[model samples]
Target: MNQRRLFIASCVALIATAMSFAIRGDIMGQVQQELSLTDVQVGWILGAAFWGFGLSILFGGPLCDLLGMGTIMRLAAAGHIVGALLTIVSTNFTVFFLSTVVVGIANGLVEAAINPLIATIYAGNKTAKLTTLHAWFPGGIVIGGVLAFLMTQVGFGWKAKVLTLLVPSVIYFVMFMGQRFPATEREAAGVPFGDMFKELARPLFVLVWFCMILTAGTELGAGSWIPTIFNRVTQSATQAGILQVVWINMVMYLMRQFGHNVSHKIAPTGLIAVSALVAAVGLYLFSHATTVTAAFLWAGVFAVGIAFWWPTMLGITSERFPRSGALGLAVIGATGSFATALSGPVMGWISETHGTAQVLPIWSGLPLLLIVIFGAIYMVDKGKGGYKAEKIA
Candidate 1:
């Protein structure tokens, strides 16, 4: 198999996955206005993507081992195409909500297939490669966010904004077609399904699973609201608010690209533990910013805190629990997205009842809690000979 071709195809697929998020987030206020939806309703609509993503990934994990990653990638592309079309034509709350769900499902499939696919092809370098592959996620967000900001400046409506999702979706679909895929690492190693299931019961896996909930929610939940929250907090231009989304993701893109350097110095859990403290500080300060300059400054801090989180979590699982395979990845990913799904509504209700400024400060608490959890884990690992990846036996 052409590892370069497959890896590039996987990155393109993730770009499409991330575009949906950036576009959806950038266009959210327009959607709310066009549909005459309440903040809570809009929250639910946005949350649907995570819900669809979580459920699809929950299924897509085992299916990767059963049906093949190629099939899952094909389905993801098709879903993105169909979901984009549905979103373009959607005029009401119900249609918009359902369309977002389709996009979410496509996003989930991308996670389900590609995490294991990268793990399989780069078996010896799973963590660094996975981190590099996931860098495209923020790179795609920068693409989508910049496009949305430009379209808004040119007086384009939300429908035109929605169309941008199709570009990457189609590109990835074409790229993935006719390319063969490798078996997942677990399968290649001949790890049984029973062994994969057994890994879930390990205490460390359980702790990581719970931590995924906080990490994913902290990163994704705040991301979905960045445009809207900054608009209210800075009382800035609509277009400028979208630019803040672009700015934060730009920071994330750069940080993730160089993350391997940081990883060489720190274990994943230790890195994430530090990320939690930094994220909490950044979020708290960002919530208090009243000027665009101040908002941009603090958003950078928040980006650095979350930049390594999602991929590093996947890397830790892949390295430390190699026997668990695709099913394990699905579980970690699904749990994170599901937690993110709930965060949308919770944040929305908070924004509705309290105010937009309160959202991030309250959201900061997730990472604060994670600081304690991951710090403890890191200390335990230090006591156990300074953290080594477990081998597949």
Candidate 2:
């Protein structure tokens, strides 16, 4: 029952996953130039990462239950090692895209295993613990961003930036070695696959799943493209791209560190409602940023808005529909990743045709939509005797 070790190991695994995102975002320009790719083509490459993530987790959830979390985690570790090697050796767009897809599946598998794993371990405080566990995501981003910035300052190549990911990757692999995994909450509760599917058919669960699409799109769509978009806006070729990423992640890191306290005061649905409104305002202002100061200010605001999104949505699902188990969490995660995958190309197309600044306004609609959807969800949940966390059986 050494939950602490398992928790630390999960955080390390997530750090590796998040670092991949940071490195990919940082080196996107280099990858495009070396491969002679257009903005649209770059979108395809970036989009593929999310697509692989979405598709893998779509199925990986049930597999996690059937195959065991330890098996999935080991698979993710192998994927990370192989994908990094492929990325290091890639010399063409096809090779690079394929490599990213491999890494993306690894990332998805990590989410597939860890989301439910953490929820099961910290059943009493699912929201708080999940938020705390996910803090490493932004934490990893900050570390990766700083490293990428320093590497660029020292005249290192993108390959070196990518190679830095191996440090955490190796740490997670070793931590996962010889570890024991707990059964999923659903499995422990003796909830069969049929009951899990039945939970998915519930009206509230369906609403939350739909909201997950917008919540993820609003957060990750902008997050995945921020480095390139901000660089274009600031027109700086130095550390501006990576620095902006660092700034946003710094804000996100702090917010997530304290998210558990915030969740205690406000219900998850209410939090999502408020977060969506703030994100909409942040996105609108970011689209209009004409100065570095303005961009940083808006980005900070946007970070606060998005910080709670992924974990909070998962928390809500875990609390409200405990029976759905890993499949429930995976479906929501898949929806978010799919939205991000769909948005990458559209955002790139906007940048290619209209400009990077224009990408924000078009995406602002997603949060606005969430404001309406989650607003209704909050009211519905409130009417049902307010928020209640399901007890793990």
Candidate 3:
């Protein structure tokens, strides 16, 4: 498949996943309220999606490599459809949670398949392209959240709001159906899958794999909780606009779209270090913002710093350790995305007991730590043989 087509497919995939947030967060909140859920049950209602998304991804990436992207995508999409239906009919929190698990399975499959697809398609500049692809994630969130808000104002029922997401799901499924399937690196390089399997446990692969874990954990952990933190800080949903994820996401999106060129020209490590620093400062400023507009600017600044971390790390991993394949991404995702899964209740507890305002700078310190880790890796790898300093995978 062509890069352009791959980009379009990625955008659609993001839109689908982003819409799930609406169903699980805003729309599901309405559902839970109508059903009179306890606060703990409501937390389960929202957190189930991420839990499912993370746990399923542990298996999904390797499975995608084994079964092929087409098969994985189709199966996951089916799960999504089923989950969506289950959500519409669910009467209690347990049923709602189970439905979201199905949706989460679908999300995990999407990440596993789509991340590698973008990497394979833009093999020469994976970081920039990957960043561009991930940008759609937050971009989709903005669109979905805004749409949900409008639908609420206009009296659109919550069930219909969820089912509407089906339109894009079907369309993307069709897109995948018609397009020629892309090959994994194993396929492209004519390496046997057995050989790829043997390489997975090598020391270099392990190093890259661990970094992927920490990198993903750092990025997703903080990113996932900020919105809820926003809720706690702002004191109401209408005031919730004061701490929008969209600001963070949009900055991330733009940086990713352009980050590839900047990354390739400059040192990836330097770029990452600088971006992280810039982001830390942004978050620090965010802690101090007293009003919505100030929070927006700081959030955007924080987004700028975060924008390049994941794709660049992936680029670094794949380029430095080309043999690891989808399993590499899967491992890191398992650890980090799961960390995101745990962060919700943890943050909730901290907010409940410690006052929500205290969570900001503490979380902000995390990315600052990332700058150190990434910088050290950059120093170690710099000027190595045939490891051209400025090139990206």
Candidate 4:
């Protein structure tokens, strides 16, 4: 199959996942109100999605290598279709939680397949291309937020908002139906499974992986709670929440679309360090913002901070540790997902007790800590003869 076709299909699949994320974020208030659930209860439901995502990719990456990307993607498409239907029909917290878990697993499977697929195909320009591929995540969020916002303007229920994801879901499923998939980078390089494990055991790999936990937490944890927090800060639920999400996602989309240029100028580790500082400050400002204007300004800063963390981390890992293959990418992704999973409840608990105003400031500490860690990585890389971008042959 053509690499462009594969990339397009992967983007379509990811758009479905991003739509689910937007719909879930937008409908938090509605679900809570209609179901008579508390902040903590809603947190559990949301947390289930991140946890399911973590678990699936933790295993799914290896499975993609073993069983092929096509199998994992097909399963992911099925999960999206079934999970969306279940969410539409959910009347209780348990059913709703289960539905998110199913969808989360589907999202994880998409990541498991596409991350490596892009790496394998665009072997020469891993960082730039990977960043370009992931731009669709925010792009999809923009589309989803606009659609959900317009639907709400017309007084369409939350259920209808969820059903919109099926459009992309079916399209990707058909696109992937009869396509042939190339072997993963590791497989093509003939790297042994034991070698992959050994690469992961290196000290540098472990350090970066640890930092990934904080990076993922900083980006995803805040994104998951933005709607609720913004609603509280702005004193508006529907329009304020959806509009804020759209604004943030649009900033992210633009940043990521142009991120390759930025990556060319700055090393990945340097970018991570800068991002951590910006994100920390943004979170603090966002938490303290008393006006909508202030909130949007700070949120733009936050978007800039988060824009490159996910894909850059993947690019760094795949470039530096080429032998680790799908397993390494899987572990990196799983770490972030799991951290987001844990932070979800923590954010909920904070919002439940301390109010949403306190959520961003508390979460800001992770990025501050990340600044230190990424700085250390920069120093270490310099000692190792400067930062050299790696490419898979």
Q: After superposition, how far is residue 389 of candidate 4 from its true place, in Å?
A: 3.8
Candidate 1 residue spans exceeding 4 A from truth: 28-44, 91-96, 237-239, 349-356
lDDT of 2 at 47: 74
Assess the local accuracy of residue 346 in candidate 2 as a C-alpha lDDT between 0 and 100: 79
lDDT of 1 by residue, 1-393 (tens): 888989988899988998898788778888888789998898688668778999999899999999999999999999999999999998889898989889999999999999999998888787788888999999998988788878988999999988888888898899888898988888887888789899999999998999998998889888778878877767776547667777888998898887656777898889999988888999899888877788889889999999999988999999999999999999998998888778877888999998878888888899988889889988988998887887776
User: Which of the two candidates, 1 or 2, achieves a greater TM-score against the reference?
Assistant: 2
lDDT of 4 by residue, 68-166 (tens): 988999999999999999999999888898999999999999999999999988887888888988899999989988898899899999899999989
- What are the per-model C-alpha RMSD values against the true structure? 2.4, 2.3, 3.0, 2.5
Q: What TM-score number comes out for model 4?
A: 0.91
Task: Write the number of the candidate with greater TM-score, choosing between 2 and 4.
Answer: 2
The regions of model 4 sitting more than 4 angstroms off are 28-41, 91-95, 233-239, 348-356, 390-393
Candidate 2 root-mean-square deviation in Å: 2.3
Clashes of each: 0, 0, 0, 0
Q: List TM-scores for all candidates, in order.
A: 0.91, 0.92, 0.89, 0.91
Deviation in Å, model 1, residue 255 alpha carbon: 0.7
CA shift of 121, model 3, Å = 2.6
What's the true lDDT of residue 106 in model 1?
A: 93
List the pairs of residues colliding in candidate 4.
none
Q: Which candidate is the best by lDDT?
A: 1
Tell me the lDDT of candidate 4: 0.87
